[model samples]
Target: MKALLKRGFNLLDSLFSRAFTPAWNPLYQLGALSFFYFWIVAVTGVYLFIFFETSISGAYSSIEQITHGQWYIGGVMRSFHRYASAAMGICVTLHVLREFAMDRYSGPRWFSWVSGIPLLWLLFASAIGGYWLVWDQQAQYIAILTAEWFDALPIMVDPMASLFLNESTLSDRFFSLLVFLHIGIPLALLLGMFIHIKRVTAPRSNPARGLAAGTLLAMLAVSLWRPALSQAPANLDMAVTEVGLDWVFLNPYPLINSWGPGNTWVLLVGLSTVLCLLPWMPSRRPKRTPVAVVDPDNCNGCGWCLADCPYEAVSMKEHDFKKGHKQSVVDPDLCVSCGICAGACPSSSPFRHVDELTTGISIPELHIKELLARTEASLAKLSTDQPRIMLYGCDHGSVVPDIQSSTVAAISMPCAALVPPAFVDYVLRQDLAEGVLISGCCEGDCFHRLGNTWVDQRFSMERMPVLRTRVPRERVRLRWLGAQGTRALQREVVEFQRELAEAPALIDLEDVSSG
Candidate 1:
């Protein structure tokens, strides 16, 4: 089932990737787009609130007035609010499913997946309450079904159905409570969203400016084309024969109507339980790799590695060794072992003697010293006359094409961010390779969360252990691509080789002869 889900997701992703530039791909920016829609809902909702009346007698009338009298502003705002809410629901659902399809919910990632479950419920509850404020036939239908469901549960002593037993049963106070929930639940949802992304370092909460503007413009066109209107004033005594529904948020209403409230509750509870528990389900796999560790003696207490850590796994504490200099410590539970911290450490340079080459923070399996040895061996096999190009790639990213050419060699790291900047310097200065090509996960879609970002910063000299100015910047090239972008990556590398051949040689042949 998981394999099928992954295949389905990949098909959609491929279609989107081909149709739109990778930077603007909707599949890659689901979470960001969802947040963008939420902002639209929040802004327009505040505008509608000024005209909305909370009294039970006036609620339906005020909505009708806004839908007609203030059609230009209030009416458009109403449609924007409704449509954005629907968009948010669709985007969030897809985001959850995509995370599941990719198997990103297990082990160290369980916190985000679990926190997102409550967020889903909060969004549903908030949307349901928003419908109640419209006071339409659809709203009446929802309230009736919801009251019936509440009554089905044994927690409440008095049946909630009694509130809808007669038209008079719903007082102004009842309308006020509904207003409070409509406004309050969304406020709570904002907090839930913060919690949802708490584990992520530097979360991109909004889509790029161009994509955001396009989305809002599209929503505006929709609003003007078919403005949202309230249905005939909700008459509790009359049956609802015809009602419009925003399928995104109201999809379950049909099931509730057919299955009855008890069965609907059972279905909802069962599905939510299954979703929440998915991360812990047993899988036939080997034991997990050990998390990153901090070498206190090697650490200079610079604290750069701690800041670079994506999962907040590293922290600094004072040590007596260097007259109260801080030492780094790693929290095994929080570290995802991406090795960005290792790359960030000033001590990660491979220029030291072989036995002494180590970093302040290192992943047990793929430390810098091990990477240095592998790189030396790979470079040794390449012919000296060839314009040898070394490609450093992320394991989870685009496959480094298995080139039949004699000039190029590829090495895969746990993530591109794991490649210490000094390795690039060593390869270039030591004449091991004429040029280095760095590739990783696509921009905004890194598998290890911050691998691409950190690596970019390092190369640009904006982070610790930065690629030095002495290395000719023209000789190094970076490309970000998705797993399916193998052909694209190969084309870029071929271009890089062509450019490297055209440029004058920077390596000193006399130094190579003497060594």
Candidate 2:
């Protein structure tokens, strides 16, 4: 368990995002919220499109009727459709920009950024369809321009001109097709969203739900007040300009129109192609484990080591250390070399970091440096009160944000191993102190070679209280932390404070006779 505690929280700065916001993951949140908004836009879009007239003549009347005539479902649905589309576009744009700010796009997340391009295009395409359903002059232009662009593509045999010539593909049919496309394209985008996030586990959700609820309430309220009205019917002949131009969706249309189809084609396809190729981008995954070699002679056969190893790399197969108990054997292939097995060894045999024993390949990384700096800071903030609480945090166990520094007096150490036996004694010697909390990585995945394991034995198993027996007996605790164990660290802090609060005044240990 000590091994699990070593993972530290990363500090991030951007908009409303935090590296580790609550126990609720922020990664899963963004993914889900993006999806939720996509669904929202889709649902509202369907409801609105059902009542919409696609013909340049009737589209304006149909939208006006839906917004003003149908006060309940159609009215609300029309505004919702527009709002949801706008919200999704805004949120996704902000979300991606936030990721960019956080530098999440550069590393393993390159795929996410790459896949996001298609999603953006699909969203805009869907947005454009929403505008086209209004069947206003703006929508007419969009429909014609979009068709012309498709016609320009060599893949299609003059699709725009062919659609205009085909008697079956009238404006009414245009509306139907746009409805079909708006729904279908977003459906495809949803699949892409999943693909973008397939590599990640347990994504974040902080702003997603909150954003959804806020969006729903806000849009609903707005629709109730001043609902949307479709503009005068589209007139390709008159060249009429004024209409309900959904800038969020149709903003690109103006640019595309001005730039000509060729430039837009180059920009869109070029950008999309770049986004799709992100996975090939180089990155790194830190080795989660190191290798371990066990000496058969000192094995206790208690299976504690086996139980302690987080990856299940260590198992007691055959030779029993204690009488008939099976001796532990470690699976080299599965082991990440976390050194939790070394901590669990009951015989108290000293073990080196797996790197030291094998090739000594394990080297300190950036996180380690961060931990040491933070540890020195934590140590300086230690306090001695009526029942002072001693907090021993492994560098990797907790994420200490700058804003949260006031409450926690943190002390960082290389490993739980560096926690000398006397330190606990020294802390306990201080009047008004309760016990000590030694938080390390999860017991099995200790980064150091059995450092926490060694600490566990010398304090708990070997040491005893002089007379009260209770003083040294249970005064020390061992907690295992994972890489993302911010909540655990916080809980430990509050619980330790509470325990100290409940304890009686510190006693003078010198009076107790050694038993």
Candidate 1 yields a Cα-based lDDT of 0.83
**What are the lDDT figures for the candidates, one per model?**
0.83, 0.56
> For residues 403-488, what per-residue lDDT tens digits would candidate 1 score against the true structure?
42567888887788888888898898888888998888776677877888888888899877789988888889888876766778
Number of the top TM-score candidate: 1
TM-score of candidate 1 to 2 decimals? 0.93
Q: How close to the true structure is residue 89 of candidate 1, measured as C-alpha lDDT?
A: 95
Off by over 4 Å in 1: 7-24, 284-287, 353-355, 401-405, 508-515
lDDT of 2 by residue, 73-163 (tens): 8888877777766777776876665454333454335555777887888778767866767776676677777887776678986467445
lDDT of 1 at 436: 94
For model 2, the local distance difference test gives: 0.56
Per-candidate TM-scores read: 0.93, 0.58
| Model 2 poorest 10 in a row by lDDT | 6-15
